[model samples]
Target: MTLASSLLSAISGLRHAFFTREGGVSQGIYESLNAGIGSQDDPVHVAENRRRMAEAMGVAPADFLSLYQIHSPDAVIADRPWDTATRPRADAIVTRTPGLAIGVTAADCGPVLFADPRARVIGAAHAGWKGALTGVLEKTLDAMETLGSKRPDIAVAIGPLIRQRSYEVGAEFVTRFTETNPSYAGFFVPSERDGHAMFDLGGFIRMRLEHAGVETIDDTGIDTYSDERFFSYRRSVHRKEPDFGRHVHALVLEAD
Candidate 1:
């Protein structure tokens, strides 16, 4: 089965797609299409599954660049081959190499893609609440800028992630963030569940991008938890599932 995705023309004129869970060869909780190599799913299956994703993106599977996300503020500058298996412990990756695809695997976390068409620089990052708060998005922008991509000229997209309506968090989640800076209060809404707060992830990301001078932002508002079309770690955990599959969102530059 072929998965569904959303695409946009980024600054670098690269082909960028946000893949969903409509296609592939997995089953049960993994069900039909699980692209997460980090999951318990068969690694061969994951490779073949990624091969399909790369094909859809119009590139070889090896051209797809991604990282084992650690939800940290770190963003790696990937200029060439890096071990995909060891998977650098980073949240974002930036590069100027064409035909190299940048991808992010996310269920509820944000998959962000950036491009500077003039400079031929592109980036992909995984931005969950921790990453966003810790500056992964800004770090990606900075990395791209260092490689000759301008922030103002970059086009960015925030892919399928957990939406505010479907996302609820405990007081500690709120307290720590609030304590870090009450200004982050806008990102969270007061929920009825005790000291819990609902987070507006897309909104928060947009704010960050716009602040960094990226006004052209595409937001895929689909919630992973609320929508069956995508996977959600939080949802899986709530159901007492031992593990959950991850969805991949990729952006790649096609050879001109």
Candidate 2:
């Protein structure tokens, strides 16, 4: 498990974890600790994996919540656990409800956990390039605000994701960002491959948070693409593997 020091020091009375792929029953490509309910991994294996994650967070397995992420900027408020069959199609989730844990899944994509202890509000977002560029982070902060969380008081931790060194983008990708905001050019640097550039996803995500008025932001700085202990969608694709595992980053507001 990886935790952000800033989040730990600033936000009290919350439980969170950026679970690695080292503690579950699944084997082979899914390996162990794969918590993605959407993957083709056997439901039993996924269930057991999620149960382990929930136990680690000190929440009941039934109270651990995740969404059917579609790489959209949509955010939903989770007042209670939803059935797996009805998972909302959202990239972020915010809640003030204690005892319920909200989480987002990511392989190479960014998984961010947010907490405003004073307000007892917490959020989790799945931010890939699309979601981040489309305002998922901002929407997440906005959702948290609706539940009484102050942006300045909210501490966010950027969990494991593909770092810039491992993330390469084509010319069109660069154009998409630059066209959105020419200043975004700073986030890209020329890669060895012609017409391609390396993207600083972690830095971009942090910048978005800062621009959104968040004062305490922590980035784990772990690269999923390079670390075998974590899952990476790109890595799976490069190897032509059938499927990829998903890591769970969750935050819970402890019951008073």
Scored by TM-score, the top model is 2
Quote the positional error of residue 101 for candidate 2 in Å: 0.5
Scanning candidate 1 in windows of ten residues, the lowest lDDT window is 1-10
Tens digits of per-residue lDDT for model 1, 1-256: 3232333552435777777776788777887568888899888777777888889888777777788888998988876655577668889989887777778889899988887777888888899989998899999999998999988777787888999998998888888777988887888888988778898888888888888789678786778899888889999999999888887887777777
Q: Give the C-alpha lDDT of model 1.
A: 0.82
Q: Which stretches of candidate 2 lie over 4 Å from their true place?
A: 1-6
The estimated TM-scores of all candidates read: 0.93, 0.97
Kindly provide the TM-score of model 2 when superposed on the true structure, using C-alpha atoms.
0.97
CA-lDDT, candidates in order: 0.82, 0.91
Candidate 2 per-residue lDDT, tens place, 153-255, comes to: 8888999899999999999999999999999999999999999999999999999999999998888889999988899999999999999899888888888
Candidate 1 error regions (>4 Å):
1-7, 10-12
Extract clashing residue pairs from model 2.
none
